[model samples]
Target: GAGVSQSPSNKVTEKGKDVELRCDPISGHTALYWYRQRLGQGLEFLIYFQGNSAPDKSGLPSDRFSAERTGESVSTLTIQRTQQEDSAVYLCASSRDSYTGELFFGEGSRLTVL
Candidate 1:
């Protein structure tokens, strides 16, 4: 089965532009997550979607960030009015269950806001 998949692997935009990053989780996986990594920093949890439950959104940095998962499979993370501070690598991961300690990650979508 395919692991997590992310699109537009690299993006460059001017400040204030909006960007959308997409992710497709592995088949049969019920737990999906979104994380962000800025340059040399470690992964930052942004959001998590499990089955049909309400998404856990506490990790989003600000109002400019949002995400949604549909059919418990594919998800998209959106950034409004992108800023230089928003420049980072957005990563997606999925696990068999929400409580599991292991998550398979995608090759991140790198965003650069000029």
Candidate 2:
């Protein structure tokens, strides 16, 4: 895909279950980011990866949320022991580099915890 692509556009999981969301960024983009948007809320940064640099994970809401990116390609966000508050739209985005500011976003993966 020419733009960022995310899988499992919609997910419904029971509380305490684990969920994994995937994202494939543009072929040449060197920076990838993960964000979360809860109902009626703004986008909240979760993680960022740039080249081989250490990812910035300061925005992760809790220890149960983790993400990994392989090189400049695919990235995955995992939620362990999911809770109701974890329900939200997980958005993935990518750019030419960390400074580009212009991000190409995916359609997003919507998670619903019951």
TM-score of each: 0.94, 0.96
The candidate that achieves the highest lDDT relative to the unseen native structure: 2
Candidate 1 off by > 4 Å: none
Candidate 1 yields a Cα-based lDDT of 0.90
How would you encode candidate 1's per-residue C-alpha lDDT over 1-114 as one tens digit per residue?
A: 577889989999999998999999999999998999989999999988897454679999999998888877888899999999998999999999988779999999999999
Q: Report, for all candidates in order, the number of backbone clashes.
A: 0, 0
Superpose all Cα atoms of candidate 2 onto the true structure and report the RMSD in Å to 1 decimal: 1.0
What Cα-based lDDT does every candidate model obtain?
Answer: 0.90, 0.92
